[model samples]
Target: MSGHLLMGALLTGILAGYGIAIPVGAVGAYLVGLAARERFAVAASAAFGVAVVDGAYALLAVLGGAGLAEPLRPIAVPLGYLSAGALVLLAGLTLLRAVRRYRGPLTVSASSPVRAFLGLLALTAINPATLVYFLALILGRGAEGGGALFVLGALLASASWQLLLVCGGGLLGRALTGARGRLVIAIVSAVLMLVLAVAALTGGSPVG
Candidate 1:
């Protein structure tokens, strides 16, 4: 029975992680595009930023369950709006910077990888979707009774998927080295971010 329970928790955690990470939303797009510009080291940091938050949320869900969700419910709408606005602003800034870089003698400065990680971390943290998803999983997936092993399983799965995304983004960067390719990707990602922002505000399902 103990072994069976462990296997059940493991499978549940894997499902929960994939459920949250599989969606390619504005955040995902920005991650890939940013990596396409900044390369693997920075992108890996950013990916960890996202993964950490997801793990934290999973842990919270397991510990607090619906009790946690209830308190956050009241603020969900306002937080959603705030997150949406932030995403829109980020999109605009990315587009503006891309255009400026393209128009002039552009020098790409090496950004601090720590900053990239923290920036993505904050961005992902603000998205209420993470909490919501974890809450649903905990409530519906029999996670409330599971122990630390369950949370560990969820964290490992989420981190693995996020790292895979980083790898894909790195490959994309290697393949698209030209300025034109970068600019095009930047613009496209910006547009996607805008759409995601609008969706976030309107109570649509989360992509990141």
Candidate 2:
């Protein structure tokens, strides 16, 4: 790849990392909760898990396996709907839990680091938009060569950004360790998730 192309790839990777990571979806919420209950080690592992899945999808896209996009295209609408519904359901459950005055540290019983990793990995992998993003990148460039470098850049960017998020959450968790503070954060997060989920379902976008 030319220097310009490499730079472009790097820049694109950064943007993609920020774009995907900024959304406070289920995974993000879970990360925050995990960090609040556990330590940075768990959160970092989960974040890395997410990055690995995202990187895999990016690679698939760059390799012109955009054909994978085809199978998903048929179910895109349904999956979007389902994802939105699931988000809503999760939000409702969260809201209910909040209202129930459940005051206890968040805990995942008998859950290992590997389970957390796999959970996030599977969650991110199911997101078809990741592939769509890669396909868009490949089509825009009109060439698949040098995609390995591009994928590497994107993966690095994504991993860095995700790790930062986990660290930030961990810090926040440390700062907000009181019971009242945790409750407030949990309530706010649940409310926001509900709103986002509603918007996502009604917006008619394939993946919002």
Candidate 3:
């Protein structure tokens, strides 16, 4: 039973992590575009930042379960809306920056990898809905005895998927060498972010 429980928890965590990461939203889009524009190392750092937030949330879910979620439930909706507004602002800025880059020669000051890491981390961590999502998954899974392993599994799964995204972004960057291609990518990503933001404001789950 112990072995079975461990395996069960691990599988569940993997599913949960993948479920959360698979959706390409504002953050994911920005990540790809940023990777396309920046170095592989920077993109990788940002990818890990995204993964770290997922891992932290997974651990929190395992530890807190419904006990913690109860208090957060009341404010989740408002927080979601607020987060949506923030996303819109972020998207607009990203688009504007992209336009500037397109019009001018793409010149970027060398930035610390830590900036990417921390920026993505803060963006991902602010969503209250993510916590609720993880809470629901953890409660449903009932991995009481294997919480640590469950968290570990979720972290690994999230990390793997996020890294895959970084790789894809790098490849896309390489393929889209022209300024026009980069501009198109920027516009698409910004539009996606705007749509997701609107969805969040209307009580939609903003996971994607």
On lDDT, the candidate that comes out on top is 3
* Model 1 regions more than 4 Å off: 104-108, 143-145
lDDT of each: 0.80, 0.67, 0.81
RMSD of 2: 3.4
Winner on TM-score between 1 and 2 is 1
* TM-scores for every candidate against the unseen true structure: 0.91, 0.78, 0.90
Q: Write the per-residue lDDT of candidate 2 for residues 1-208, one digit (tens) a residue.
A: 5787777776776666566666656667766665654567677787888888777877888765656767877877666676666656656755565444445445553346787688667656666777787777777766635677667767787787777767777788789877666667667766666665666567533221
Q: Rank all candidate structures by their lDDT, best first, as comma-separated numbers.
A: 3, 1, 2
lDDT of 1 by residue, 128-157 (tens): 778888888888866435656667777788
Error in Å for residue 200 of model 3: 0.9
List candidate 2 stretches off by more than 4 Å: 1-11, 23-26, 88-111, 204-208
Q: Give the TM-score of candidate 1.
A: 0.91
Error at 100, model 3, angstroms? 2.3
